[model samples]
Target: MSRTTKLATIASASAAAALALAVTATPALAWTAGNFTATLNGTMTIDAGVSASCTSSTLKGTIASDGTLSITSATVDGCGVTVTPKALPWSGKLDNGVATINGFAMDAIGCTYGGNLTGGFTGTDLPVTATFANQTVNRTSGLFCPASATITAKYDFAAS
Candidate 1:
């Protein structure tokens, strides 16, 4: 074959190969908004010195666009053995964007998540810093048990 013909043939094959590769290339996986569950930690200042820490489970919510999450309505079990954590249909945000939970407000139940979460999504645990204020209790026992108890806790948000 002529030199020009050979060069042309090689170039054509290269172009074809490039085109095939491009056509078969997979696109990047984008992070989508979805539901997730998080574990809780820290402590709940019940009253005086009577308190309960984070439980095996705490909040369930959906992933927000900003890497935070919304607090789903559910009952949190294990509150000082005398009481179960109050179930709330709370609308809260976390991870800077899990559920300080940043700007989480619950006026009807009187609770809020505290602190400022920063950085991007890296599947880290968001600690819960909440104060459940003056929760009315009717427990017949416990040193810290009061008719009205305030719960202050800091839990972690583990993405699943």
Candidate 2:
């Protein structure tokens, strides 16, 4: 074969190999009741900027046929401060790649409460931690935090 033909063949082969690698390197995602960890990150606007993070492991949850993850119950105890309201309900849509929850609850920031954890997700068995942005929350007499604040959240599902 001529040098030009050899170069073309090499280019085609390299292209094919690259394509194969791309397809094969794709990750596998699974959203189910497996070894998972939910992490909370960011700050709580109170008397001071309180750092917060809540991590839970091996939470029992369910995945619908459409890839909707229904986490029955999970506890996240890292509110930068000590308080009673620790755990919060968590739900998500694996198919749509969205983190969600139902009802109002106290959040990770010590006393100040009223924040919902929500973020985007991906396909595959808890490949990466999903981060939900901080939400606006109102204060109550219960936590002693009179002013409202915002909180961000991050969650990771343990591989199946």
Candidate 3:
């Protein structure tokens, strides 16, 4: 082969290798920093001896650039009982395909429960589903409250 032809082939091979390295070295951008909203996919049930099913619930929050989730407000309605979120801002982390919420506390009919919740995230992009199944919470107060309770719910999150 001609010397000029050999030089061109070598340069082309080097450029292809560099491109491949750049693609592999780039970090995955799983989540972005922006306002987000979470809506209940169905009924949210809390079982602590006495089962209560809430028809609807909404959560509003913001995700930082570093994938830190900050829930600013959350509201649950229906089931003939009022469910109130105690903590003003609950923090968590969204990484890989998992979602975790730390220090989640709620009150209902004088009873309060608090614990950490872990769930999985489904979806590649904007709208993702967060399903928390049988997350256990211990009673923080109230004589009538059970020692422990389980909460199950699926929430769909989207950018607002």
Local distance difference test, each candidate: 0.45, 0.53, 0.88
- Residue 104's lDDT within candidate 1 is 31
lDDT of 2: 0.53
Q: Poorest 10 consecutive residues of model 1 by lDDT? A: 105-114
Deviating ranges (above 4 Å) for candidate 3: 1-19, 24-26
| Cα error of candidate 3 at position 22, Å | 3.1
Candidate 2 residue lDDT tens string, 25-128:
95654444443444433322222245444433234456554456655555444444553443444455554566665343554434535545566776554555
- Model 3: lDDT equals 0.88
TM-score of each: 0.40, 0.50, 0.84
Q: Per-residue lDDT for 51 in model 1? A: 51
Q: How far in Å is the alpha carbon of 91 misplaced in model 3?
A: 0.7
Model 2, residue 39: distance off in Å is 5.1
> What lDDT score is found at residue 76 in candidate 3?
92
Model 3 poorest 10 in a row by lDDT: 24-33
What's the CA RMSD for each of the models?
A: 10.5, 7.8, 3.6
